[model samples]
Target chain A: MIHKSDDPVIRCDGVWKIFGARASEALDAVRSKGLSKEEIRDRYDCVVGVCDASFDVGRGEIFCIMGLSGSGKSTLIRHINRLIEPTAGSIYIEGQDVNALSARELRRTRAEKIGMVFQNMALMPHRTVLENVAFSQEVRGHDVRERTQTALRAIRAVELNGWEDKYPDELSGGMQQRVGLARAIAADPAILLMDEPFSALDPLIRRQLQDKFMSLSAEMKKTTLFITHDLDEAIRIGDRIAIMKDGVLVQIGTPEDIVTNPADDYVADFVAGISKLDLISAGKIMEPIDAYTRRDGPIDFDAWPEAHPNQSLDQLVDLSIATQHPIVVKLDGRPLGVVTKNALLRGIKGDTAPAASAA
Target chain B: MDEDTTFNILDPFSSIDLGIADSAGGIKQWAIANRDLIQPIKAVFNDIVTAIDGALNAVPPLVMLALITLIAWQAAGRRTAILVGLCLFALGLLDPNAWSLAMTTLAIVISAVTACFVIGLPLGILAAKSDGFERLLRPVLDLMQTIPAFVYLVPVVMLVGIGNVSGVIVTIVFALPPLIRLTSLGIRGVNPSVVEAARAFGASPRQILLKVELPLATPTILAGVNQTIMLSLSMVVIASMISVKGLGNEVLRAMGRLDAGKAIVGGLGIVILAVVLDRISQGMGQSGRERGQRHWWQSGPVGLAWRLTRARNETTPPVSAAPRTEVQSN
Candidate 1:
């Protein structure tokens, strides 16, 4: 699921956003005096919205920023499109510094390179679904027939073909969000900025949309920076997840890296509610077959239940339950490691013991 | 001395006169000096009033009634159209001269409302976009709304000179604040996230205003327009004091001789026109909500024609399909 590129589609380097008139002064203090967010607020009356956030989103990578409310995950995403300009630092889209661009060039970058979807599904209430979907292209002054065709294609992609003529208010919450997605993709932008786009939906609808978006993103190979308060959602679809807390990114890693080794208590608490059964892979918790053989006697690979190295913990649990012996984790019929019951238990507990030893 | 003898709070400054007359005289002098610029602007207003009044008068009274009723039917609905038709008919029957006067009054109101939008829409948009502009406009709008109409009446009459153009100018001054305030409110009330989405999608400020914000704010803006129309109508009668020709003049002349019966007729005429115009404009605002609900060929007179033609085509023989094909090929 991860698409690694040497030149990332989106790169934020020490971007800081402080809200209020004294933001620049506060930013100076932050750099020189290392003022805490509270001290900065008290002294300068400025709230640190995003503080020194830096991340790279590779081409086609779904980089999810997960945090609780007021964690500044939303603020961090806005910097990509320059909706809220960074109080300091630089953001590059396709290696072009966003902040350095002139207003016209910035607009051009937004129209040609980036599209954003909002949590509230901010579709124009007066516009039909088709018009909403076609908005970006229309703003770019594309010919009516051309944009309409593009819009219809996107609408069909989101499975909103029949509802294209209906206004946003006429649609249900989930459907309206689908229109929002369609609108973003209709522009065919290289990067998609989604700010908690499905967080407002019911759980079932959210899951459905997440699945739909994942499939669409994969098929289209759209590099996306997704903002969400839900850790489960980040773990579900993100190639890499960045956990934000109070304007700072505390952790950035693959789902397995995050769950097994949370950087601090904040991230650990956030991931505590999330089930690791699906996120942890057999490869992650498996010990090298040689290590298992060194500890015990020679093992017959045939006696143990076999599973792929990529098999999730949840799947491995089922295989473990069916057999009394450890499971052989293999890749292309070559045994790579073994997942013993002890290792499996530690994995389920989200303990890094097995993964740490395996590493 | 007065403060020492009597317990008067403002005794010391009571004898001092503010330069109120001087400022008034200065403004008058400025206006007189700016006649070259004001003349063209005054001509534009005069032309609009004349054009509308002439066009309205060109139509026979019964034809005008039917035309307005038809318009109400399309813009509002059947019930409102019926009410409008009945009211116009009643006015004509009640006062022999009511029809012509009503036309003139309608012209003045239309011109004034148009002027209000011309002056107010940009101000409203400016207010919506900038806090500083809104802060400045807030007090001005308050002053415009709170100051008595008669307070500015003399100044406006003296500056613009007494005529239909001056009447419209006065009416615009009276009717404009609500349009500006409501327009600003409507634009401001647009979902911020929606505006942000537009910005995120790279919409220019102009595009966002036209394609997203303005369209979404239509119902509210239309409500503002409805208020403007009502305000203009009320002001039009008072504008008769400055010799603007309208139903207001009819009432004014009737009142001058203390002709109670004639004044009653004229007053009733004004009431009937107000109700009709008010309902029509209000209905238009209401219909703004249903704007996207129907097909383009399912609403107006075009829709009526389309429906009739479609019905005929459907009922006709299959042979008609050949002609349609031929027409398309041609």
Candidate 2:
């Protein structure tokens, strides 16, 4: 699920997007000498969208960009597709400069390689579900039979097979979103740019679609740049998460990395509501079994609490409360380490383990 | 040029009978006095009406009926096509001049609205694209729509000298605002997220307009067309003051002779056309026209929509189609 290759599918470097008549000048001033966002806005009458944002999304990676409204997460995602051309800096998809592409080349790249899903799943009301799904193919002049078959497959993938002939207006909000998802994947593009794709849905439906998206991304292995204000969603789906503040990228790391070791107070406040249970694993906080037994006198062979090395802190807490016995951390049924009472308490409290192993 | 003859054709309300002063001129005075400003504008309408009238009348009545039926069928269902066919046929049989006159009126409406769309669509698109342009157009459109149709018609007839051309010019002035207003409003009202999706998916500007913006904006634009047609039809009897022949002219003649029966028949003709065109255009504007369970024999555009509606009327949302009950094993 996590792709850690040297060659990333999408790379953006030092991207700055300023919105004003003198945007370039404003950007230059910001880069040349550090200026506060308020100062730049007051002095130059320019609004910063994305300021010195840089990141790489490895192939098949779900790189979630998370920020609240006006945080420039949306603006940053638009940069990958060159929908908002950068004020400065470069974007390369498989090493071809996206900003440098001609209009035709950009369109071709968008059509063949990128698919985008938006928060507003306003599937074309005039078109049937099948037609909406097959739109990209139709635009590409693909033959009817072949494109429809592809669209049908995509529809079925989203569990919308029986409703292909229904217009978007007739479908429920969640169903309409599924149709949108089907439309995006119908083209089978190499990249997916999802801009808060599930943000509009009810919480129940949102979770359902999020689960569906995770599996679909795993199956399709499409490199996805997912944008969301919901950190829970980012933690659920992203292999790596980038947190933005104002118009700047403040931190980028795995969900575990962010939760356990937040980059700053802003990111800490953002991740504060996030539960530590899913993020902190036994492998991250366990002491070696030999050291544990030597310190604690002896291990009970029969009464010990056993957990897999990857078990979450919440699971360990449950096990700890269920019994007074120390927890045995086993990998493939062989005891690799121990989760003592002290270690269990620290894990639940989200305290960084001493000599923490990079996981 | 005589007041008695002019009085025979003027809207009854347009004439005021003030004793002693003899102020019978009423609203007509404004038009007469503004002749210097009104003539060139009237001349333009005269030319438009002439060109469209000649082009439409050149086709035989049967050919015209067939073409109208074809368009009706495409826009609506077979019911509208058949209805238009019957109306056209009945008009020809009831009065030999009826068909020709109807065609003339039809030509004028067609030219005015087509010209409206041609001119209005670009302006609408521009208005939608630029906020300043839209703000600027709002008041101008409001003025175009708010002016009394008869007041404008008086000026047009007085300046253009009352003919098919002058009648059409008046109709154009009456019917144009909605098309421009709705086209721009429709484009502006398009869902931004949908447009973003199209752009994100690599749709060129032209492709987005054709496939996304235009299709999504269609219902509003079609509504505009319907309003324009209805408004134009409403102008018929009023327009006949210019001596333009049509069902409107028949009504005017009946009014002059004080014949209610002739007026009724002529009014009925306009009503029939109005209903038929309104229903057909509204049907086209409605979505889900072709997205229902259908019989295998469903064929042409009208047939497709017809059968689909018929089939839909007989069915409910399929309960068995609920796939949500499936376990999320994936």
Please identify model 1 stretches exceeding 4 Å from their true place: A1-5, A287-302, A328-338, A355-359, B1-10, B22-44, B288-297, B313-330
Candidate 2: give the clashing pairs: none
Residue-level lDDT of model 1, residues A87-194, one tens digit each, is 998998888889988989888889878988999898887788988898889888999999999999999999997788776877899999999999999979999999
**lDDT (0-100) at residue A351 of candidate 1?**
73
DockQ values of all predictions: 0.77, 0.51
| B1-330: candidate 2 lDDT, tens digit per residue | 236634545576445454533354544676677777866876776677777788888999899888877777666666877887887777677666777777777776777677767777788788878889888988888877788877576556665567776766677677878887888889888888778777777788898898988877988998988898888888888788878777898999999999998887787778777776787777667543442423223434655676577668656664532422221221
Query: What lDDT does model 2 reach?
Result: 0.81
- Which ranges in model 2 have alpha carbons more than 4 Å from their true place? A1-5, A288-311, A314-325, A328-338, A355-359, B1-103, B130-166, B234-243, B250-330
How does model 2 score on DockQ?
0.51
Can you write out model 2's per-residue Cα lDDT over A23-139, one digit (the tens) per residue?
988887888877888988998999999888889999999999999999998888888889899999999888789988999989888878988887888577767899989888887
Angstrom error at residue B288, model 1: 5.4
